[model samples]
Target: MLLAILLPFLSFMIRGKIITGIICLILQFTLIGWLPAAIWAALSLQNARAEKRNEKLIRAIKENSK
Candidate 1:
């Protein structure tokens, strides 16, 4: 819940995606763009998490195979 509120800032600070953050910030200033920006941020975060999980799983699989 709290994360959803600050998604744009978190996207920039934690994920280091300047462009995403900037886009979110710009969208926040507009009437229609706010929701889209938030959705985009959430998706970006989800994708990042999924990528990390996949990387960890691959590493684990390699270790197990060895």
Candidate 2:
């Protein structure tokens, strides 16, 4: 989350979204776009975490059904 706020472009690259990272880098270059880019990065990070949690829950459900 902090990484998303501090370095939004790098955060997207770290998450394997290179194209998005490049676009974010361009947004970061402009003072007006930085806030929106950081918000987008933070939301993306949150979504990734939620997806991971959902996957783990699904796996656990499958194991218990066995």
Candidate 3:
């Protein structure tokens, strides 16, 4: 996520979110948008992590119940 802090737009690209990345690129160009871009990228990363953990938890529960 260090990269995301440095280049917020790239975070979306790495995640295959081309359109959102493009939007971030535009926002990044506006100097004032820098902070918000970083915040958005960081939040997105956290959300992705949460989703992965939830999926793993569900899988584990299913296996245990079987």
Cα lDDT for residue 12, candidate 1:
58
lDDT of 1 by residue, 11-33 (tens): 65566777767767888888687
Name the runs in model 1 displaced over 4 angstroms: 5-10
The alpha-carbon deviation from the true structure for residue 28 of candidate 2, after best TM-score superposition, in angstroms, is 1.1
Clashes of each: 0, 0, 0
Q: What is the RMSD, in Å, between candidate 3 and the native fold over all Cα? A: 0.7
Question: What C-alpha lDDT values do all the predictions have?
Answer: 0.73, 0.98, 0.93
Query: Which order, best to worst by lDDT?
Result: 2, 3, 1
Rank ordering of all candidates by TM-score, starting from the highest: 2, 3, 1
TM-scores for all candidates: the values are 0.80, 0.96, 0.95
- For candidate 2, the per-residue lDDT at 4 reads 100
Per-residue lDDT tens digits for candidate 2, residues 2-65, read: 9999999999999999999999999999999999999999999999999999999999999999
- Return whichever of 1 and 2 wins on TM-score: 2
Tell me, by lDDT, which candidate is best.
2
Model 2 ranges with Cα > 4 A deviation = none
Question: lDDT of model 2 at residue 10?
Answer: 98
